[model samples]
Target: MPELKKQSQVPSQEDFARAKSKSRQFDEIAGRVREAVLDEFRERAPISSVWLFPGQDGDLNGYVFYFATSDVADSLESGLSDEIEKALVRKSKELIGSGCSVIFDSHESVVRKCNGNYFQYLR
Candidate 1:
């Protein structure tokens, strides 16, 4: 089994409900971040969404971006973890001194559970 990536935090029930209610706010912020991700992985990964991850410390650590890839395993075969992390940190820190985490997920884990992604409903 592969070691799951760190700096990633799953949303709680409250987080989900809050995100749904305030979907527009999140979408606005994420819309801008999308450019950063694309700059790094353009023509590589299809991004699903990016949203502020409200941290336990009562601050935004960074954001979580889910990929809309067909094969999570194969998509990661290049093992570009270092490059990806550097891109995220450089971009995020430039914007707000934050870093990010990329999520390799399936529809079952996200869509089936949440019905749909919040960003899709907005932008």
Candidate 2:
């Protein structure tokens, strides 16, 4: 008789819950970062909302939380790095206060999870 092949194991409820939890965490973090970025950008120039994008193909391939505008999504794109820095610092504090280890990409992951819409820098 021929030996039967074993099937791949399916993810258990616990596994699925873990994934969901991670996703939820990402969303929360992303939302916070998005808001912070928008607030910071508003200090520099008029903005619409923040947009997150996944870096791909020789690009950063991570998450970029940025304000949007008509000019390449916005005229304030160049000024975003500073805003992101500020957001990170603030977020770190918040995370520390909450008694949680700020996991890697805690901010960026949130940006990516919001389908890249994480935050909007409205005018």
Best prediction by TM-score: 1
List, residue by residue over 42-89, the lDDT tens digit for candidate 1.
666544444555445433444334454353454567655345556666
TM-score of 1: 0.49
Top candidate, metric lDDT: 1
Model 1 shows how many backbone clashes?
Answer: 0
| Model 2 agreement with the true structure over 1-123: per-residue lDDT tens digits | 999999869998999999999768765765675576566657764443443322223111123332332333343356444445546456535642221111123233444565534453111
Off by over 4 Å in 1: 1-31, 58-70, 117-123
- Per-model RMSD to reference: 13.8, 10.0
The collision pairs in model 1 are none
